[model samples]
Target chain A: MNAMTDRIAGVLVLPQPYVLFLGDTTVPGFAKTAFGLRDWAADKCVGELRLPGATVTTGLEALTAAEAHARGARALVIGVANLGGVIPANWRASLVEALEAGLDLIAGMHMRLADIPELAEAAHRLGRQLIDVRVPPPQIPVGTGRKRSGKRLLTVGTDCALGKKYTALALARAFERRGIDSDFRASGQTGIMIAGGGIAMDAVVSDFEAGAAELLSPDAAPGHWDIIEGQGALTHPAYAAVSLGLLHGSQPDVFVVCHEPGRTEMLGTAGYKLTSVEEIVELTLLLGRRTNPAIRCGGFAFNTSALGEAAATELMARESARLGLPVADPVRGGPAFDVLVDSCLA
Target chain B: MNAMTDRIAGVLVLPQPYVLFLGDTTVPGFAKTAFGLRDWAADKCVGELRLPGATVTTGLEALTAAEAHARGARALVIGVANLGGVIPANWRASLVEALEAGLDLIAGMHMRLADIPELAEAAHRLGRQLIDVRVPPPQIPVGTGRKRSGKRLLTVGTDCALGKKYTALALARAFERRGIDSDFRASGQTGIMIAGGGIAMDAVVSDFEAGAAELLSPDAAPGHWDIIEGQGALTHPAYAAVSLGLLHGSQPDVFVVCHEPGRTEMLGTAGYKLTSVEEIVELTLLLGRRTNPAIRCGGFAFNTSALGEAAATELMARESARLGLPVADPVRGGPAFDVLVDSCLA
Candidate 1:
């Protein structure tokens, strides 16, 4: 995909410029993963097919399968990797209808759509492809654990779906302006599509997770470093392992811990409380030093989406004091990148 | 291997028992992994061949290749997965000589000896076997993200090799006396050999790390719980990822924090200071809750090897007070397991 309109770009909106989200992504928890996938490309979403009793964002209309087809939608993407992320029968019926309507299916849940024979058969008969973003690359390397000269900065997080990718992307963009020389090493599908040069780390077999990290951190150009996108939190229950491999394999010189300012509970866990910024910074160090003692906590980047500008600023100020490191909202114009590059790459 | 005369059983007293450690494992940093492996089997070691001036534990003699052979050495194990854990040429020569000596070779480093054609050829010509403890199981599943019952109590640590396995083992043994019903789920070679079942978490492909955790946490048998040996620290420079996967995959109901008393600096990281007990515990919760929100820090277990008994005791008391959790060394009798069970399982 071209850099201008990456995969998330298309996923956010379909080729026919009309899309239907199979599941209502309006729930606070279930919508975290898939809802964020296309928020940047919201215009393509014509409406969502709600599974009654679910509320979603107001951007899309609630449409039935017939209504979605009558409206000219091209694909049916599972918009929520819900509480267990399994494609259940209720959802299956909707997916089956979508497939029979000849709509392509795109999903990023732990469960693959093709795993269900009925869905695979329906998609096959319908002449539409089922895309599983978590699929690993055809080839992956065994990690050499060799150290390199170029600096690597990875964005870790307090929990899953907490803007790690956004922080890394912001760093990449900031680096571009500063001419500090860097590459955004994508660790997920949204990233891979955006950067056009990364592997979906989760799809890779566990043994090669670190290897994928290693491969992603290319030998530096004469004046370049790699700003690798961090995956799940090292503490994330569902995806910590994936994040761990990225941390070790990347061997980053410094890491930035991403946090959601108003997120008191971890996304997937039933209701685990969030820890303070100071503690997270230290905990991250405990994990980072395993591979590289020189690794440092560059700073913190808050996902300030839930807060007003002033409130986010106040929270960040408190966090900065707590961790004694640079902190900012990487999403908006801020100092996180400056602090990240200066302190880390300095 | 027989439980009574396991591999470690022989390494502790090997000249009469016969042993040959291929590389120098005397340095404080490089020795942690290998030294721990056979320190329990020291009497079996004839001598560890050195790279001229490379010192080893006082227990093992620094013997020449022929001297070790004359001493009836039967196996050639790479004593150290030294700096970067790579197989360097300096150590390769000794491996070749050991093969010619008709000794079996065992390695636990990131580098597999079998990957080296010349080394494999030498072993083949010598009729000696090559054993890689870290080799992952043949097949690992992508996690179902399903929640499980039967208390999964995983041991996490401030750093690697700080006694996570020891803690798990201690819990297992303690549970045995109390008839509490539990399995010592091994995650590393030492734990594997000790428990007689487990996959080397690191050896498996990255995607399967969590899968390994799932498999290790077998369908709970009736009322029995699973006390899984944890691997690598969440903040380890090189190994946080491995630890992350183990934490997420195990889906423990409660976790015990492992620490190395008086270890101001992390093992491999140059000059990187360790974090506080409170931070590690909190960080672990952040990761654990992603899978199980109720995942609590059961207690703290200290590796106390670097400090005097009294100093270690003082350290534990202070840490316990600071974190409001019971703390003790798992090796010697203490309240860690009790605190662990009461706080977590209750």
Candidate 2:
């Protein structure tokens, strides 16, 4: 295709199943994912839609048929499954058909596979291109032993408007007042900083590529604690997807998901509840386990005025314990919320 | 016009301006009376160009012309002037022309006798329509023999995002803790709240209309103690215009204009520096004298983190005495700043 035609056709990697496992539920994560893709496509001026897939035994066949329908698809993103295995036999024909139709498959594998000869052979037979998303095992540096330095905690929140960023910053400030060298990672803030570079194709493409590379590489140097900030209402799924990409890339020691108050009760106009602190935390923990198990995980930190620090702490503690992780309070106490930050990192 | 066509052509009056004011030396006060007329035939989008003479002068000619131009305008907004009187001749003509062009002029001042006569005459002449922006002024009851009881203090910040809302909220909290009854009125926050309602209009239009109605009406009650936050980074002229309107409308007992830390320093993106805080203060004091001679005004509240409590207090006292108003500290104690809400209010 010519340059203009290629631009119009727009090569997109549609993740298989159209939705990945978010915690234990098979909810409509597409709207959220699609929103993120839309945000990425903003400057490109491209349109995108997620293919539908069933949850039952016919799910694989259904996904393949959907892929077949996307005949002119230039790229295919094979979403990583929790369990590692070969492609199902029933769906093999559809996969070959997709390749014959000139689809470049990008297989994202969360598992630490020693080899993928079978998959490679299948792709070769179909005359398709493949890019393996196989992340290596995380390891601490030689000198940096796994010695607990009194739980050097790193807290992260969403954005200032959403109250998560402030909550995290307040927690960090509280820790500082208490003589704790806690690192507060405002990933949302960093994302805003990066995005503020302006909505341009090259910028976004570089950001995505860099984000992907960062996700695959595990760096032992102390992670820079940053908050994530944005203008739009927190319901946009793009926020959640970006959060996922950042969390995966940064490999934060402990993730502290911050959320707005009363967000859990509201029917998010974005057709999903990525703003729900509990839901996001659950998904983060699940993704962490599947993508990088070495990264230790924490729990949610909700706004104090919304959830009340005590209730929020207890509820989060219960939830974290259920997930076999450390418990932390989202908000600090007066002077500021002091107990919450101290306990979370401790 | 058909329903869809009418909907497309319908003028939407946004009730607030989400403005980021940048710069220091440009204007001494807020801009309340600026008019914006977009040429849909050219770019089909509202360009950021303020109408000349509309803000500075006033008369029927300027008003008429503005109205005539607005007749074919997809949207028309009349920013209420705070200081200036009598619309300029050229501006009158422009306004009338807009009305004749079949534009829906949305304004808050349509109820005023001076404004109403022209509006009705223009509507009759143009055979067009008009929509008055109706936002009821805040009501605080007063009885016979009722006099101002408690001290009325107003907090004016340097600009937006300079921690104005934070300072205001902290001050309120501090006063509450000190058993002092304090009420807050922030034009900045109010503007944002009104805009968040999804009123389809531009920032300048909404803000100007809301500001004019809020500021000028005698029926409007100023909060017991108001914290009028200014827009930060005064790059846009609209911020100054809005600030001026707020200042003129909500005549306060004592005005505390917050100044940045340094007289000559670059902070924030716009690189704004208050070259002559004293000169600006003098100008404001002069304007205050013109409006209300008895009104007392406070000098600049320079944000300092290095000064000791005694030094800061002394500085405040000296500045307040110089400006003929009480000295109030936004951050109490020297450099180790603690938001001393109670002590400051007290």
lDDT of residue B344 for candidate 2:
40
Error of 1 at B132 (Å): 1.4
Model 1 alpha-carbon drift over 4 Å, by segment: A1-183, A188-238, A244-346, B1-106, B110-113, B116-130, B334-346
Candidate 1 local lDDT, A1-346, one digit each (tens): 3212124312221233335464644466666544544553355556777776566653577777667767876666566666676887767778888778757776667789899988998878887767666666545655556666687889988877788888888788788788787888888866653453467776665556766777777678646878888876655445667877788788788888888876787665545566666666776676666566788888888888888888877877877787787788876665655775576666
Question: For candidate 2, lDDT tens digit of each residue in B145-251?
Answer: 11223344444555433445444544555556556555444334223222211111112221122223133222324334544444332111113323333333344
Off by over 4 Å in 2: A1-346, B1-152, B157-163, B174-181, B189-223, B232-238, B263-272, B289-293, B306-328, B333-346
Worst 10 residues of 1 chain A by lDDT: A3-12
What Cα-based lDDT does every candidate model obtain?
Answer: 0.69, 0.36
Tens digits of per-residue lDDT, candidate 2, A1-346, equal 1211111212211223221111121343422322332332233211232233523121222234234435333544333233343443443454454556555444334322224555467668866555333221122111111121222233334332454444545555555666654443323212211121111111122113213223222233343233222122212222222333334334344555555545543222223333444444554454333223444434445554657556866665665567554344433444223434544555
TM per candidate, chain B: 0.68, 0.40
List the candidates' TM-scores in order. 0.52, 0.25
Which lDDT tens digits does candidate 1 get at residues B126-216? 8766666676656466555467767789988887767888778777877777878888787887555334446778765555576668777
List DockQ, one per candidate, in order: 0.21, 0.01
